[model samples]
Target: MKRPNGEKNISSTITLYADDGREFKQTFTIPLKANTPPPKPGYAVAKTTGTPAYYVLCITVPDMDKTAGEGFA
Candidate 1:
């Protein structure tokens, strides 16, 4: 899905789908803070400057495929 680009900050969820028709739901918390690069490039990298939480859930399916452009397995 296409996202809106503007000066206003917005927080949304991003879902990553697998080729097996399984999807992983993740809620993203975006911070409306200033963007700054660290002294070192690889030191820190984030969509925005804030704390982000991540949770992983297990999905049991028969087959799993990780091919690009392929809809499902």
Candidate 2:
């Protein structure tokens, strides 16, 4: 999915297929801003001042066993 130019935020849904024929899905939104810090272990700041600008979208997925297999396991 691609964010249109000048949009304030972008969002998309992601789906993951497990080995046991189960599927997990989640939607995420990322805001576009300047002078903001990126996630840990990131490449560059999100459009920081006086630096080369880069847009970053970080997605954090929880432990799969706890999220995908809640009670079915």
Candidate 3:
């Protein structure tokens, strides 16, 4: 999931599962280095602090977009 800072696009596929044991796959694209904001259901960059710094991918889920909700991973 590593890309150059000057890269212009990010694409990836994600899999999700339901409580009933059903699975789904979705492909998404996010534009980079654009004047306007990226589209919804994109991702944000985060950093971790410690001996070695690492980047984290914080994805945005449209269905889970709420002000108050419990988080689970």
Candidate 4:
């Protein structure tokens, strides 16, 4: 599947299909925050002065795929 991209925060679930036909469900969200400044010639990494964004992932195992309130695995 294509990766999602945007300036807004995202929170949703997605399904993944394995090569062996093992279908699995997973939920993931990417938070959109301020853009960090680009690194200069001497900088090894770009520094972020603002709040950092985050990613949340919740995967459902094969055995418990049908359980209710099964958030993160």
Q: Cα RMSDs of all predictions?
A: 20.8, 15.0, 12.2, 17.5
Pairs of colliding residues, candidate 3: none
C-alpha TM-scores of all predictions: 0.24, 0.22, 0.31, 0.21
lDDT string for model 3 (1-73, tens) is: 8754445444445567889988766644544353444346878999999769999999986655445545642
**lDDT score of residue 22 within candidate 3:** 87
Q: List model 2 lDDT by residue over 1-50, tens digit each.
A: 76544543434446667899787675445554434333345333355455
Each prediction's whole-model lDDT (CA):
0.49, 0.50, 0.64, 0.49
Off by over 4 Å in 3: 1-39, 65-73
Off by over 4 Å in 1: 1-7, 28-73
Candidate 2 residues lying further than 4 Å off, grouped into runs, are 1-4, 25-73
lDDT at position 44, candidate 4: 32
Q: Residues 1-73, candidate 1, lDDT per residue (tens digit)?
A: 5533443444555667889988777655656632432232222332544467544444444334445475762
Candidate 4 Cα errors over 4 Å, as ranges: 1-7, 10-12, 33-73
Worst 10 residues of 2 by lDDT: 36-45
Per lDDT, the best of the predicted structures is: 3
* Candidate topping TM-score: 3
Q: Candidate 1, after superposition: displacement of residue 43 in Å?
A: 43
